[model samples]
Target: MEPEKLRKRINELAAKKKKEGLSETEEVERAALRAEFLANFRQAFRSQVEMMQVFDKAGKEVTPEKVREIQRKKGLRDD
Candidate 1:
């Protein structure tokens, strides 16, 4: 599902829960949607972080070691 749609549904479910609560089926659906949204968000965030480059003063590359290691494993950078 698209991110926006997933987000919208999650919000709708949240509002519904706050106002009237959900049936068992709707509760299950909400759980599934929330899990899916989290998975997608984490993947997008990881991709963004992996593609990032950091620099310090004097033009030195200062990307974190953990991120550099991830980039190396993904073949996005050279060791």
Candidate 2:
């Protein structure tokens, strides 16, 4: 294709996108939702960190492998 044709096509698409109105209110709503999501994520992250600290200080490692071993030793597996 010609360079001028490509430029015209690009400009047309840009204009169309601009006309579609990706709104400021929508952006503000998205930011508010994201802030709430991040706050919840941080809370959960801190809780997990605290849980790990307690597990470490209490001298117990809550690993899947350890749970599996305990289950095996106790004959707790149905299969």
Candidate 3:
């Protein structure tokens, strides 16, 4: 399912759970949806972190070596 729909369904399931509780099947579906959401969230956050550049007041790069290596591998930086 698409991200938006997945989120919507998850919220629906949560509301149902809060008001009346879920069936076993609905509980399983909610668990799967939660896992998918977390995986997507982690990947997006990692991508943003990988693309970042940190600098100091002196105008020199201060990005960590590990982050720079990841950016280099992704072709976002050259040095």
Clash counts for all predictions: 0, 0, 0
Using lDDT as the yardstick, the better of models 1 and 3 is 3
lDDT of 1 at 43: 96
* Candidate 3, 10-32: lDDT as tens digits: 99999999999999999999999
The candidate with the higher lDDT, 1 or 2, is 1
Candidate 1: TM-score?
Answer: 0.86
* Local accuracy of candidate 2 as per-residue lDDT tens digits, 1-60: 344554455455456557885457655654555556567669787556443322456778
In candidate 1, list every pair of residues with a backbone clash: none
Rank order by TM-score, top first?
3, 1, 2
Give per-residue lDDT, candidate 1, residue 29. Answer: 97
Q: Compared with the true structure, what per-residue lDDT tens digits does model 1 show for residues 1-79?
A: 9989999999999999999999999999999999999999899998999999999888899999999999999999887
TM-scores vs. true structure, each candidate: 0.86, 0.41, 0.95
Off by over 4 Å in 2: 1-21, 54-79
List clashing residue pairs in candidate 3.
Answer: none
Error of 2 at 19 (Å): 12
Count of clashing pairs, candidate 1: 0
